[model samples]
Target chain A: MNTWEIRFAMGNEAIAEGALAAGARFYAGYPITPSSEIAEIASRRLPQVGGVFIQMEDEIASIAAIIGASAAGKKSFTATSGPGVSLMQENLGVAVMSEIPCVIIDVQRSGPSTGLATKPAQGDVMQARWGTHGDHGIIALAPSSVQECYDLTIKAFDFSEKYRTPVYLMADEVIGHMREPYVLHEAAGLVSRKQPDPSEPGGDYKIFDFERYDDHIAPMPPYGGKYIFRMNGSMHDEAGFGCGASDNADKFIRHYEDKITKNRDDIVMTESYNMEDADYVLVSFGCSARSAMAAMRLARQEGEKVGVLKLMTLWPFPDKEVAAALKKAKAAVVPEMNLGQVASEVSRYNERKIPVIGVNRVDGSMITPYQILDALKGLYLKGLSLKGL
Target chain B: MKQRWEIIFSGVGGQGLLLSGNLLGAAVSVIEKRQAVMTCTYGTETRGTFTKSDVILSDGYIDFPEVLDADVVVSLAQIAYDRYVDVLKPKTLFLYNSNQVKEAPSPARQVGLPMEEMAAQAGAPAAVNIVALGILTALTKCVQPTSIQEMLTRHFKGRQDVLGANIKAFEAGLEEAGK
Candidate 1:
């Protein structure tokens, strides 16, 4: 619990320190590029804190081991790149359905089967939601700065523990490898899921309460605890028993969706810069937001009414906040490291019929502020021509 | 908002530009209590390919960490100079090593200084990056000269010779740039 310490560190180092600060007692992960630093740091530091660290044979085994550790009542996590995350998909799907508490780090690189290992791409934005296959709820946080890399890792763990689900920290290589001066704060407030009371009457213990699942998370009992139950991945009843009732299956999926979406007010967060009286709104996440901020500042200085909406939380898409920020703007320009993964989402979620333009760059080179300004300049002409200003 | 100092160090892999960027960032943010962000990106090349590091030194918080256009671009080799010459603004100060680079076809307002020769005279030819930092500090006055000296001493703690030679090279560069 070191506090008020200032040091120069990489983005990945900050994330590892953040996770350790959040009381993560177990780390089981395989090595991958741009993200191996998280595992390497955890290996050296976890033992000092009396935590367990293991390097499994492959990505699949690494995820499986963490899930088992979490079942045994340990705050666990694993770090991987695209290829490793792709390999951990099936187990990740299982974790999603079973509502296991774990944090997964996808330090994204160029993808589609062993692509550029060291180069960065935000190409996994869509994959983070749908990659696990079935219909389930997931919370993903995107950090743009080195400080947020630390802060958001704590947030990722908090959401996973509070909601009893797997969370993803979707960071690219630029944000993962970039170094800066960060003042380390006190340990974050750790959140652990509610466990069933061991002393409760045997007849009163219902581990998975179905109707209350919307507002109340089910109390999970550790494997060696007094309560006995099955941790099944398939469709199950309130007591964790196998069930073939069609109505019960209908209730299972609905509760999962409502539990997260009904609470999306707290789960989704966004950052808005100079949104008042803006003509063009720049929407971005992760490293792309940094360049967008710079471009927005430049446009303001030149007397152009441009603003930026940085999506700190990528999943559960902050629709209301985005619409509010762009209430006065004429259009939005989405700049992503990938080819408009979030841009497409913005266009779909845009309720005001505000034209959404996407500025995409995927060559492992960053989309500079100059590029964002170019997109806004094009939009400025369209706005002027329509209004005859 | 006042513009922050945007600086770029460009060279081949072995010239220690990345460490130079780190030293500058540490000097400003750690000792001087100003905000700074230093970034570096490299390909698979070890010695010959283009490698660059950027340092954004600001008085307040930094929103953007990357520098697309730089106020100063230091070129340690001929290829780096040629690669960056076309991108320089008329106001940019393009600094090049006189011994390593020969020609600048465009009018880039460059000052060809013998940074390598200055390092050689300071008893450590490997300290060219520090010398370049010294020149930048002396010319721009973005940071105090003593702060960079303190950072260099802390960065090379165990090797006394490395520390002393880099200090001498940095002083020589500062003196030359002042003249």
Candidate 2:
């Protein structure tokens, strides 16, 4: 085990190093702008570390290759952008339904359809949650800085392996391409998948065991192991056989969501800055969170009683934390690259009906701190006017 | 020293703006044990296109990576200089290439160095970016000249000729700044 070493690194480089540190032994990805660096670094580093790096023909094949590699018992992952993720959505469902442990890095660019190839955007927040066809719980983490790009990628793998599902490290082009100083520390609290104990098993082992593990998560042994079981993508029984019975279908489908939701306490992560006596709250994630933090600091310097709630975990939505942050605030501001993907989500938890303003920009540039600070000032004055009434 | 310094290196692509920015960032963050963040912007086409690298160095945390207000702005091309000259803060130190940028009408305290001539005299005309970096370091003292020299040695380790030329270019830049 090596000690911590600090170095200046790009966020993509940090993420690549993070994946390697987290014991990722397989990478199959298609290169895209703003994300090509990860594939480039993985290509050089994985080979040196005796891991496999494959450049599949397309995004669909790249995701499928990773799913196959994960099932074969290698910690596997892939990196891509929006169009690439759009291609991988079908296979992403395969990982979700089959419960394969893998990591997918989406270095988001401006896009509905390749809108700006090399520019940064946080447009994929909602897509990361609901891109695939079915209703299933997903784990996605957004990194605000190069350091979080390193830390959260390791956590992404840990969550994936532990929950037996695909995980996303949702990085925008700004965070992905920007360079900063970060400490490379050995990954602690690393969790590998729970493989079945051959001695304690009955005649046949359940691949999707809902009984033994109260979390509805079962042991996932490698394919060549002595425990022979089917890995079904359809509505499946504990034995991995397809089941059409209405109750079994309902139970199995609910298990996918419950396994994650029941463990939300452990899964959801958030960071609150200056929230103790905050009158206005700035809620954001990914690169936009950096702007929000800057804006909050500026507002604080002016003594406006502002704070920031940065959501590290994008999916499973960190609802309780967000609600708590909004509970005490007079108004909430969401700054995102997209029009209002996360802003709409923030509005849902505004039970107080406080104004939730979104500082949106899709012009292939970052949402500046002044833009957010201006929005904060507007909300502050509006509060004053209401008090005057 | 100021608590934080925001610098922008603006030029056309293929001018090594990003490399210069990265070198400065590494020197400050790695050697000086401070914090630095650099974000770059460039068009899809690689060469002869608009490009800029924004570097922020702080003794404390840097929340926003991009340069909101530049303290030092280095422009190596007329296009680059023209784009930023009008928007500079009055306190900004605007450094430009004397050969490339002809006009300089701005509120900033401007210094036009013969960076291209310096690079040529240093025997690596392509190392004009290094010359600009040298001038930036000399003018601001943002990082120790020795630290940048160490980074240059490491950055161009395998190619001895390139290393020697860049080191000379950097020294030339430092000397020009003294003049």
Query: In model 1, what is chain B's TM-score?
Result: 0.95
Each prediction's TM-score versus the true structure: 0.91, 0.97
Measured with DockQ on alpha carbons, how good is candidate 2?
A: 0.92
Estimate, for each residue in A1-389, the C-alpha lDDT of model 1 and write its tens digit: 56677767788999898888888989999989889999999999899999999999999999999998887888899999999998999998878767788999999888778788878889988888888877777789999988889989998889888887889999999899888887678764578778765567544345667465545788877766667656777888877788889998888777676667777898998987888777888999988998898888888788787888899898878878877866677788999988888988887767778878899988887888989888877776775422211
What is candidate 2's CA lDDT for residue B169? 94
Q: Model 2, B38-70: lDDT tens per residue?
A: 999999998998899999999999999999889
Task: Give lDDT per model, in order.
Answer: 0.84, 0.91
Error of 2 at A148 (Å): 0.4
Superposed Cα deviation of residue A145, candidate 1 (Å): 1.0
Which candidate leads in TM-score? Answer: 2
Off by over 4 Å in 1: A201-207, A210-214, A383-389, B1-3, B113-125, B157-169, B175-179
Error of 1 at A322 (Å): 2.3
Which candidate has the highest lDDT of all?
Answer: 2
